[model samples]
Target: MSANANTTTLWRPTGPVELDLVRALDRRAWPPRLPDQPIFYPVLNEDYAIRIARDWNVKHSGAGFVTRFEVDTAFLARYPVRQVGGETILELWVPAQELDEFNAHIVGRIEVVHEFR
Candidate 1:
């Protein structure tokens, strides 16, 4: 929706989401949560940028969504530092109507799942 430069919060890390989960990922993979095209975003390790696809996982999962699909050496290359750390934030490009349902599933992993819903 806007430039990736903004450090605004999508969803803040609070409680379990805030404490351990945000900083415990060795690797994370998400499905297409953005657009199909490429975009530039800053990383914690680099100053310039990296090219990322909005819907990068359409073929594998068959859904326009991001998942914790796997973790291998190759998988390490899929994310920018911004999206790294714990619970590597991902998306499942869906319609606005499905947000509530999807949010419910994710809540299962967090302490505030019920409050978030």
Candidate 2:
């Protein structure tokens, strides 16, 4: 879906297992985090997502994917942007408990924009 002022685009780098769970949800929402995962981090740029998918997820899981989606800008305001590394390495750290609410703010289906194996 096309993004407008009310929505912000976000990208997620996911492994095969997580990608399958997203598919099982009809591409509309992310699955609940595993017990050890307390945060759901969606990166702010495609390049960062691509870096993680290609360099991290692929090596760890044998495959990786970058998915893009839009979320309500207002809803996203609750979380501050986090810079984990270089200036372009930005992310939104949504608490795992809030994922269902976050999912409700998604504007459209999550689309897989890149993949590596």
> Cα-based RMSD of the predictions, in order?
16.1, 1.3
- The C-alpha lDDT values of all candidates are 0.26, 0.96
The total number of steric clashes, by the backbone 3 Å criterion, in model 1 comes to: 8
In model 1, the worst 10-residue window by lDDT is 45-54
Per-prediction backbone clash count: 8, 0
Model 1's TM-score against the true structure: 0.18
Local accuracy of candidate 1 as per-residue lDDT tens digits, 16-77 = 22223223532221122235424322222211111111133223232221112112223224
Name model 1 segments beyond 4 Å from true. 1-91, 107-117
Error of 2 at 44 (Å): 0.1
Q: How far out, in Å, is residue 77 in model 2?
A: 0.5
How big is the positional error of residue 108 in model 1, measured in Å on the Cα after superposition?
3.8
lDDT score, candidate 2, position 86: 99
